[model samples]
Target: MRTVDQKLRDRRRRHILTAAISCFIRDGFHRASMQEICKEAGMSPGNLYRYFDSKEAIIEAIAEDERKENATYYAKLFRAKNFLKSLGKMLGASLKKASDPNYERIALEVAAEASRNPKVAAMFAQNEAETKASLVLALRDAAARGEIDGQLDFEAVATILIAVADGAIGRMSLDPALRTTALMPTMKIMITRFLRPPDGP
Candidate 1:
């Protein structure tokens, strides 16, 4: 099922992506060039080009990888016994992940760059739409089970939830002292109260 050639290709691809991320974090996505990525990866331009010819390609790859990772989390949510609590924990984890400076800087810069690049803008928009769809599905399912309030529009709730998480990320990005541990308890309380069933909980 495995071949040395395929393994080597995967390793090279990972190496290139890692180097690209470092270049983006250090010099920024807008300023980081292919040559810088090649230098960072310790590979010739030709060699690196074979794996990924453009920074946009690397960003697309990163988006795809994150999409797969988020899919796993959404899948796990379906099996969670305490839906609202699990949802709170997932949001807390997301906030912590998104608050990392290295991640935030690169992600924000990429978002900025995407505004000027149609290809990247389309790719990013699709990724955001897919994530929102997954969230709406999960929220609707929770409501159907009578865990969350079924009266509220799942689409609007998902949008607000994502916006809240994004706001936390932006605020924490500016103020590193706003620790996740401190914010999470209040967030958890807010989530539980917002989604909890009236007669059941």
Candidate 2:
């Protein structure tokens, strides 16, 4: 029940976001002007403005897109039968994404922006809360199934997991030589040993 105009609008919006990301990655977020994004997007200022009033609006849209992606990923993790295995796979996938130079740059930019912009902070904070909650629920289910230690503090563990990912992102950004694929096996062993039930064989 979608109109052609609506579909076209959506496509245009995505196009603008893709162009904006490239600009933002090439230059820091503060240096990436709307005019530059317009040029990158192959659109006039008036047309780009119709889609996004300002850089902040574009950033908000990007955050929303990321939130949706995280939601979908966490939903799948919650439904997974093997929680530990699923969590390991999720972490591995996240590390792989963080290894991408563009993704790392964007992530660092967003984190810096969140510190300076209250609205950006709140948006990412909400996403973080939802992600942690989903992880906690998944962990609880895993405990119930005797897959992990029931006595473990799920909230703290969830926080640690997120922190580890953030740390990995930071490290990869700083050290180009650090390979996520090479580190994944060690990461898997650490997560397995940390979460597995005490009596687990």
Candidate 3:
């Protein structure tokens, strides 16, 4: 059902984005130039322009990719059997991702860019809202199954979880030497105690 030309186009777009990410990571988003990105992609400006018109376009594409990735992750999480355990694993995986220097740097840069760019802010906000909603639903389901406290406010708990993730990412950015794996045990214990229903096994 797919044509060769379409496949090639998709490949080229991915190449461009890969190059752009490297450039953005090396030289913050604002400083990364289209020319530099073209060089990194091993393409001329004329060719690269065919895929993305400007830096903002590239940023938008990256944000869209992130949104889709998050959706896929949440979909899998929702299907998981043990909600609290799955949530803990998800948090740990997220912390591991944040521990990557390049990822941490890019995340920080995106956060900074979002503050000044309304479009970027809106894009990230939508992703945040969607992720939080999914988390709230997961919390409610877990409660119904007696995995967590039934009386706890799922919405507030979801928000706090998101905040905790953001804080972890921010902390990683600030301390490159910090190892997320070392912190997991403590994090898991805290989450389990906070969510486990009273008198739970």
Candidate 4:
């Protein structure tokens, strides 16, 4: 149980994080300043500092929120009765989210930065591991239910699926003009091959 004061503080902290994410999405992480974030959050510098020690802390908060959201999505996916249908929906949802220009810009930029910054890289690695675990669970369930071949390696297959999805999103970010018709067929072929059973119909 949380006290009212504690709840209020949590709410304010979430608000500040939301504002910071919006600012970071609109302006690259390197360009977005604490002052701008404070202004967007409707909090003074002192108040913002009460919630986050620094801009880096705010960025981490934003990244953590995204990680949690992805986890929740995977949870829902695991709960789905028809694994194939759920997988399709999950891929569609991810593609739609990635299509958002703001999300694309910030996510791609942060990922690149993480490659160069030890702190950011550590955070990203932690998030990636958690996400991979969730994926492995989902893939295992799918295999148990016969949606995927039982003999295949769940963790490795999950890794490949995640990599393909990430690559699709990255490619879309690079060339928004490419028709989904052109790319989705390639994806469908790969997925169909993976999901196909050994025995003939």
Per TM-score, the best of the predicted structures is: 1
- Give the Cα-based TM-score of candidate 4 against the true structure: 0.84
Candidates sorted by lDDT, best first:
2, 3, 1, 4
Which sections of candidate 4 miss by over 4 Å?
1-11, 178-189
Model 2 alpha-carbon miss at residue 174, Å: 1.8
lDDT of 3 by residue, 95-130 (tens): 887787888788888889999999888988888898
Highest-scoring model, lDDT:
2
Off by over 4 Å in 3: 1-3
Flag clash pairs in model 4. Answer: none
On residues 1-201, what C-alpha lDDT tens digit does candidate 2 reach at each position? Answer: 479889999999999999999999999887899999999999999999999999999999998998888888788887888887888899988898878899988988888988998988898899899889988988998899899999999999999999998898889878999999988888889899999999996
Model 1 residue pairs with clashes: none
| Per-prediction backbone clash count | 0, 0, 0, 0
Estimated TM-score for each candidate: 0.94, 0.94, 0.92, 0.84
Per-residue lDDT of model 1, residues 41-150, tens digit only: 99999898898878888999988888888888888888898788888888988888987888888788889889889998888788888888999999888889899888
Clashing residue pairs in candidate 3 (N, C-alpha, C atoms within 3 angstroms): none
Indicate whether candidate 2 or candidate 3 has the larger lDDT.
2
lDDT, candidate 2, equals 0.90
Residues 160-193 of candidate 4 have per-residue lDDT tens digits of 8788778778888789885444665567667767
Scored against the true structure, residue 92 in model 1 reaches a CA lDDT of: 84
> What lDDT does the true structure give each of the candidates?
0.86, 0.90, 0.88, 0.79
